[model samples]
Target: MEADKVKEACAVVAMRCKQDVAQYIYYALRALQHRGQEASGIAVYSGGLKVKKGVGLVSDVMGPEDMDKLSGKVGIGHNYYSIKVSRPENIQPQSLKTGIGDIAIAHNGIIVNSQLIIAQLKKEGKLFLLESEEEAFIMRLTDTIRATDDIAKSIKTVCKELIGSYAFALLVNDRVFAIRDPYGIRPLCLGKLPDGKGFIAASESVALDVLGAEFIRDVMPGEAVEITEDGFKSINIGASINRAHCFFEWVYFARADSVIDGMSVYEARKRIGWRLAKEAPAIADVVMPIPDSGRAHAYGYALGSGIKMNEGLMKNRYIHRTFIMPTQDAREISVREKMNPVRAVVEGKRVVIVDDSIVRGTTMKKIVKMLRDAGATEVHVRIGSPPLISPCYLGIDMTNRDQFIADHRSIDDIRKEIGSDSLAYITIEGLVEALNFEKENLCLGCVTGEYPVNIPGERRRFQQTLEGFT
Candidate 1:
C-alpha cells in the first residue's frame, strides 16, 4: 500500500477553549489521510484525552454523523498504515500507563534498531505486548520520563538515546508535542491557527492548508516542537549522519501537489519521467500510464521520449482498497474498478505503459489484459522503479517477502505473467539516478534488502501489509 502524509500525528491543543476544535481537528485529519488509511484515531484532551479509533478512513473512523460527538477544543488524531506491524490493533493513538502517569502517543515512521531496544528492555524485565516498535517506544519513554516532571525534556532525552526514523506526537497531560527523528526518513510539519489559540502537527503541509491554517516551517530533523499555552516552542535533540529520505515518497506515495524539503513531488516525478525517456527510449504510438501512480512518470516518459502521451486508460476514483487487502481477488476487483483501457486511443497502436513500482504481478496482469481487450497492437511495460527484492523494516505497508513481483519471479517470468510483449524496469542505479537522490541518503532496503538495521526473529510479525486505507 502507498503510505501518504497522514501518518504524522495530528493535534489541536489550546489552553483556552474553542467551540469548533473537533471540527477543526477533523478537517486536519482528512487532509492528512493521504499518509495512512489502515486505521484512524482521535484523542481529545479537554480535561482527559478520550480516544476513539477504528480500522478505516477518517470518514469511516469518525463518520460524518459521528464528527459532532468527537468534537473537542483540544485533540490529537492518528491515521495508521501498517509498515512494520500489519494488525490493525497496533494502529495508533495508543494509550498506555507509565510509572509517572498515563499518556497517549501517536506516531508515524519507523524505529530503526527497534529489536535491540526491545531486547534491552526485556533483559531488564520490561514487559512487551505491542507489535510495533512505536508502542514499545511509549513504554520505554514512559519508564524514562517517570524520572522527570517535565514531559518535553523527558521526550528529548529519551529520543536522543534511540535510533531510527520517526515523526511523532504525544498527548501527555494537557499539552502536545511533535518530534522528528534525526535521519528525517519521514516528514512532519506544523501549522498555526487564525487566532493563535490552537496549533496542528501533521505529516504534510497539505494538511495544514486543508485546515485553513498557515503553514509553518517543517519540524526540523532531530527537533521537537511543543504545543502549549505559550503557543509553540522548539527543542533541538541534535542531528546525525543518516538523513536518508525515502525517494518513493515523492515518486508514488505522496500527493502530487505536496512538497517536501522545499521540493515539489509532482515536479520531481515529471523529472524522473523525463529522465526515464532519456535513459530508456521506446518506440510507441502513444504513452499510457498505469492510471494513478504512473501518471507523473508517464508524463515524464512522454516529455523525454518525445512521444505523445495520451489518456489510454481511465480510472474510477472510487476504487476499493487494494493496497493492504489480504486476498488477490479483492485486488483483482479493484483493478477492474480502478482502470479500463481506452480502445479509441490504444487500438492498433504500440503502447508504452509506465508505472511507478511493481509490487505484485496480479494487478498488472489484469491491467495488461484490459489493454489487450481494447485492441492494443503492442504493449510494452516500463516501470519507473528498480525491482523490489526485500521487505522494508521502516514504516511501509509492504512487509511480506513472498508477495513482491520482483522477489518471486525473474524479468522474463514477470513479463509472461503480465502478458506484456516486453517488460523493462528502471535499473537500481537508474532509479536512484532518476530520483536525483543520493543513494547513501535513501533506505533502499526494499530494492536492495541492505536494511540499515537488523530484522526481528518474529518473522510473521507483519504480513498481508495491504489491509486498510493508509
Candidate 2:
C-alpha cells in the first residue's frame, strides 16, 4: 500500500468495431488506468492510422477534442509506466509507415532480446526513429510485414526470433492483431463486443467489462488473434514448452474485479489472506488493510482469524501511486500525503496491517510510524505474498535486487528496519496453495530465484554485481 511497492509495466487495449472506436478505447484505457499512469496514448485506423499521445494521465493527455480527432473503426490504446527515464517519444502506441500501409503498436512487458533484434534489423538496413525499446521492436515487425504479406505469419516469424515477455496489440491499417508471448509472462484476454459487431483484446478482462463486451477467454500463451470484418481468428506462435504466467498478476498488478487465465484475482487474494491467517496468525484486536490493494486480503484475513475488519486507513483518491513516482524523495512525500490513519479505529488497539507485498521497506517504515503516531498500541504487519528475494526481469519493475529488504535482511531485521512490532510474510508454499495451481504453472522466480526463461550469463553476473553478492 506504500508508494514503494512494485510497479506494473504497462497496459494495452485494442478494439475492432463497426462504429468509431476512439471513445471506446478511451473508456477502456480509463478502466485499465491503474495498471500504468506515467503516459497514455491511442491509435485508430480510419483510413490510415491517426495517433494522439502525450506524457500525462489519461484524462490530461486525451481530452474531448483529442478524442474527436482520433476517429476510427479499429484502434489500439496504451498506458505506460517507465522503469527508466520518462521521455515524450517513448509514449506509445508507437506507429510507423510501411510500403503496404501504416502500422501502429501498443505493448506491455519487456522484450529482453530487443537489443539483439535491433542489431539484426540495422544489418538489414532497417532504420529506427524512436528511442523506446517497444518502438524499435515494432519497427522489426515492419520489416517482417515487408518480407511477408501476411500479418500473423510475420508476427510468428519475428516472435520466434525474440525472447522475453510481451503482450501486443498492433494495428496495420484497418486490421487489428493481438499477440501474447510464448511463456505468457504477462496477461492478455479476448472478448466480443455487444451484438457481435466487434472484437476486443486487453491486458485484463476489466477493460472488456467497461465496454459491455462479453468475456470470451484468455489469449493463450504463444497465440496471435487477428480481428477482421469476418470475426476473430488465432494461431499459436508461442514456445512448445509449459506456460509460466507471472504470479504477481494475482498478488498485486491486476484489479480485484478482473480475471486472468480462468482465475479470479479477487478470489486469489482472498485465498492468500485466508491461508496467511492460518500460516501466520497475529493476535490483534482489529484487522485492517493498508487501503486499496490490501482490502480484499484483509477481509479474508479477518474472516479466517475471527477478527473484525475495519477501515483504519483513509487513502487520497487523487494522488498518484507512490511506487510510480519519479524520485525516492517524491515517493517518500507521497507516502505521507497518500494515506492517513483513522485514529478512531486504531487508537489504543493492537492492529494487524495487511499489505500485498514489500519492496524497499522505506515506505513501510513510514506507514508504521503513521499508525503509532495515531495511537495504536501495537502494529503487526502481515504481507499477503512471500518476501521478494530476487528481481523480476519479465516486466514488473523490481529489477534492482539491492532495493529488496528481504534479500538483504532477515524477518527480524526487516521488522526492526520497518519499525513494526511484528512482521510476517506468506510462505511460498502458502502462496502457491492459495492459487490452487501446480507450482510449475506459475512464475515464482522473484521468490525462488529460479527463472523459467534463460537469462544470459553476463546479465546474471551484472545483477549479482549490483546486489553485491558476486
Candidate 3:
C-alpha cells in the first residue's frame, strides 16, 4: 500500500562553509522553492545541531529573526511537498542521536519498502515517535550505525535494505554526507563554493547556482559523499547495475534551468517539444504554452512546427501550483485561481496548447474550457511527455493507477474527457531520444508500467524484488 501514501517529492540542500551556512541555504531553498511549498526547514551545527522547521513556505517559516538564530558553518535544508495534510512533526531534517554522533537528514524521494522496514524494526522492540518514513529511516540508520560502528559502512548497510529512490543530505556532527540511491531515481549534485570556501550537495544544480557555487558533477548512483570544512570524499556504496534515472525530473518536477545527469533540462524539454511536434503536428493558427513549465516545451514545438508561440494563459504569481496540492478538491479549486486566459491572444484562434504532461487531466480540462470560453475557435493539446499509464513508486504523487487519465484509455477517449479538439502525447522512444539517454538508463515507470526498483505488487524491469525486505 505504499501507493496509498504518496507524500513525498521534496528538496534537500546541504552546505559546509567557513561563513554562516544557514543564510546560503535559505537562498538555495528559495531557488528550490518550486520543488516543494508545503513546508521548509534548516538544521545547522553550531555548538550542536540546531533545527528550525515549520509548516509553510520557506520565507514564511524562516524570517530574519529565524535566520539570525541559526548560527553554523555547516547545515542542511529541506522543502517538502506532502500529499497529506501538513504537520510540524513531519517536517524534516529529521534528526536523531546515534551511537556515532548527532545525525540530521533531509531526503527527497519515496521509500516503497518503508512499511516492511518499519514492521521489522517494531519486532526488534524499536519505538517510533511519529508515523513518518523519515523516522523509519532514522531508526534503521541508528541500528545500522550501532552494528557497524562506522558512518560510511552504516549508510551502505541501510542502502542495501532500502528498496526505493532517495537523495539524502545528512549532517553527522560537523560533517555532511550526501547519498544517492543505486538507481539514481532522484537528482543530486555536488558543487564548490567561491574561493574554495566550502562544498555543497543539493537536489538540483539550480540550488547551487543561487549561491554562486560552481557545479562540479552529479553524485554517482549508489555513491555516498562525506564533506567537511577541509574537503570531501566519495565512497561507492553499491554498483548501479541498472541505472534508472527518473525521467519525470526533466519533464516537469525539476526547474527548466536545471541540468540533471548532465542533460540540460531546458534543452531536453525543448527537444521533446520538437519531437512531439514531429509526431503529432497540429494545424493551429497560434501555439500557446500553459505558462511557466510549459514555456520551453512550447517554444521548441513552435520552432519545430514553424508556428508562432504566444502566451495564451497568464499564471497568477501568488497561486501555488495545483499539481502538488494534497487533495483532488484542492487541486481542482486551485486551478481556477492559478491561471487566466489572455482574451486577445486566444480569442478566435485555432490554439495548440503545449504542456509538460497531464496526470489526472482535471487541470487540462479546466484549461481547455477556459480557452473556449475566451473565444478560442479550437484548443488542441500537445503534451511534451508520454501518457502516464502507471503509478510512480519512486517519488511522484501519481500513486494510484486510477489517477492517470491515460490509464486504460485511448487518445481519442482522453481528448473527449478533457473536451479538447485533439490530444497527443510524446512517444516513449521520442522522450528517451530527446533526453539523450539510453531507454534503459531512464526510469519510465509511470509511462511503461515497469519500474526499475523493486516495488511490491509492481512489475520491475530488473530481477530485484522486495521479498527479502518483507
Candidate 4:
C-alpha cells in the first residue's frame, strides 16, 4: 500500500563565478528541493574543499551560519532522496582528495553497473570510505586519474565503465565539470549567470530561472563540460546510437514550469491530457483533477472534452509529498492529510478525475473513497501516461515488480481495486505523440519493459553494450 506514484533520484547543481556562490547554490537547491528532501549538502573550494551535510530539508541543514562558513566562488550542491537513510555518509556532494586535486562530486541518476566496478576495485585491494554508488564513482575516477594524470581523460574513462543513466557535476579545485551519460536517460543543462560573472549547470532549467541566468543549452548526451568563472568548454565523447530521454520527466518528476530538452514540461503534460481526452472521454457531468499533480492534465482534458473543469480537491500545501515519504505507514498517513474533497463541487455529480499515472492503486483507492464519501456520484479515472508495468532502473524509485498495480492487473481489475466507476490510460503511441518525440528517442522502459541500455536479466531495446572503456 505504500505506492506513491513515482520518485526521482536527486538534484545536482554546480556553479563557478567571480563572487562567492555558496548562497546562490543554496537558493538553487531550494528551487529544485522538490526533487529530493532526505538530505542536503554543499561542497565548496575556497583554497580547499569544505563540505557541510546533514539528513533533512535544505532549510533545516544549511542555515545562515553554515553558509557563512562555506566561502568559495566555485561549489556544488546536492539534494538527496535515499531509501537507505540510515547511512549518513551516503548523503552527497561527496568530496574527497584525489591525486590530481581536491574534487567534490554530485550525481543525479543511477549507475547500474557500479557493483561490478566496485568489485573490481576491491579485488585490486582498493578500500572505500563510503558505501554508495557515488562512492564507487569517485573511487573509480581517482583510480583512472592515478593512471591518466588528466581529469578530462579520467572522466571519459569513467563514463565508459558506467552502464546506466548519470548526470554528474564535479568540482575540481576551482573548476566545475558537468557530464551526462551516453543515452541521456536523465536531464542536465548549462546556464550562464547575468553579467558574465559565472556559469551554472543543474538538473533542471528551473534552477537557472531562479538565479536569473540564461540557459545555454542541454548538456549533450555523452558530453563532459569544464566550467570556470571566465567561461565553459565541452567535449562530446560518444552520443548513444539511440536516444532514451526519460519520458517520465514530463509526466511526473519535473516541475510543470520547467522546460527540458526543448520541450516544456507543462506543455507535454497538457498534451498528454489532450490525448487522454480523445482516447478515453468519460461521460461525466464535470472534470476535476486529483489536485496539483493532475491540474495541468485536467485543464487539457477539459479543453478537449468540452467539459467544465472545477477544483474539486483542496491540497494541504504543508504536507510533504506522500510519494517521497520513507515508509508505507508514513505514505498512507500522508495521503489522508494531503488533500480534501470539495463536497460542494462533486456532490451529486459524475466526476471524471484526471491524474498523471497510477502506480500502487492504494493512494487512488483512498482518494476515490474520499470522493464517494464527499458525494461524488461517479468517480472515473483518466491517466495521462500509460500504465507503469515495469520498474525503472535508470533513476526512479519503483524498484520492485510487485509494487506496480498494472504489472499483472487489467484496466477493469484496477478500476475495481480503486473503487472507480471506470478507468483508462493514454496509449504509448499517444504519449510519444504528446511529448513530440520519436519513439526511438524516448525511454518508455517503465511502460514497455524494454530499456535502451543493456541491463543484465532485462530486455534491451538495442544490442548496445557498455564495453570498450573497460
lDDT of 4 by residue, 1-470 (tens): 12365777899998998888889999999999988889999999988999999999899999999889999999999999878656888888888887777888999888888888888888988888875778778878877888987878878888877889998989878778989998788899999999977999999999999999999999988898888656778877677877889999999889898999999999999999888999999999999988778888999999889999999988887766345579876755677688888889989999999999888888889989889989988999999889999988998888978989998888998999999999999999999999998999899999999998777788988676545221
- The sequence of per-residue lDDT tens digits that candidate 2 reaches over residues 160-206 is 77677889998888889888987788999988888866889999999
Worst 10 residues of 1 by lDDT: 461-470
Clashing residue pairs for model 4: none
- What TM-score number comes out for model 4? 0.95
Error of 2 at 10 (Å): 0.8
For candidate 2, the lDDT comes to 0.85
**Can you write out model 1's per-residue Cα lDDT over 262-339, one digit (the tens) per residue?**
667888888778877777788789998877788998998999998999998888776555465778766566666667
Best prediction by TM-score = 4
Predicted structure with the largest lDDT when compared to the true one: 4
Residue 416, model 2: Cα distance from true site in angstroms:
1.1
lDDT of 1: 0.71
Model 3: per-residue Cα lDDT over 138-256, one tens digit each: 88887777887787888888888787899999887887889999889899999999998888999999998988899999999989998877667888888466689998899888888
> Which residue ranges in model 1 land beyond 4 Å of their true spot?
1-20, 63-73, 83-89, 97-99, 112-132, 195-197, 229-231, 322-334, 408-410, 454-470
**lDDT scores for all predictions?**
0.71, 0.85, 0.85, 0.87
Deviation of model 2 at 451, angstroms: 1.3
Query: What is the alpha-carbon RMSD of candidate 4 to the true structure?
Result: 2.7
Cα lDDT, model 1, residue 251 = 70
Mark the 10 consecutive residues where model 4 has the least summed lDDT.
461-470
Error of 3 at 20 (Å): 1.9
